[model samples]
Target: MSRDHQASSQHDGTAGDVVVLSQGDHTLVILYGDVDVRVSEELEHAGRFSIDAARRTVMDVRHVTMMDSVGVSFVVRLAAGLRSAGTELELQGPSRRVAELITLVGAGELARWLPELPLEADVSAEQA
Candidate 1:
């Protein structure tokens, strides 16, 4: 995979980063730090670029420390748009706080896009 686009900035005194990595028909968007209203514009721009660049987009937010309603809305809307376009959008590894916020807002179904745990891990959890 090659990183074709990246943007980072300090908005409202909070640091945020976006990296777009592409491989064939797949693109991975790595997001870090806070993703709130302050950085919505930047995030939206990046999301659009990713959607246009690949048939499958994976948004990896594991490094994101915080997210607000705007961020959640962005993800939902992006996914919907991609689906309508016959593409796919997946959210990977949202932090617990972000996950709770998404769930609270009735977006828990988005969690289905999260990267699955290893088979061994799933089996152990089931046994436990």
Candidate 2:
């Protein structure tokens, strides 16, 4: 991992935050605040950078307060890209709102990326 590659962005008008952390073979992306269409570009850039720097990437969205379809699309697309490159992508601790949106989109299957969830939680809608 490249410590120098770790970056964070914050702007008054932006709806969310992105912080990249280097963790050996994996990169940890901490997202906070609202992650709607407003931050799509930032998310995409950060996702690509992390994927390029590490074979495994973990997006920790425990602090995300809100999200929309754009956020869901970003995660799904990122995961697919990483998988195609023989890398791995995982989503950890997504907030209830974000989780609900993902579930509403029938993206609970994407929970395969969420190692923090128990096996039952991944397979059952009750936990989603």
Model 1 reaches what TM-score against the true structure? 0.76
lDDT of each: 0.73, 0.72
* Top lDDT hit: 1
Question: Could you give the C-alpha RMSD of every candidate to the true structure, in order shown?
Answer: 6.1, 7.4
Tens-place lDDT digits, model 2, residues 1-128: 54544344563333687777787768788777788777777788777887677578888877777887877887877777778778777778776777788778866565354655533435786655
lDDT of 1 by residue, 1-128 (tens): 77677665432334666777787878787777778776787778777887677478888877788887778897787777677767878777777887788778866664346664444457899899
How does residue 53 of candidate 2 score in lDDT?
Answer: 74
Error of 1 at 101 (Å): 1.5
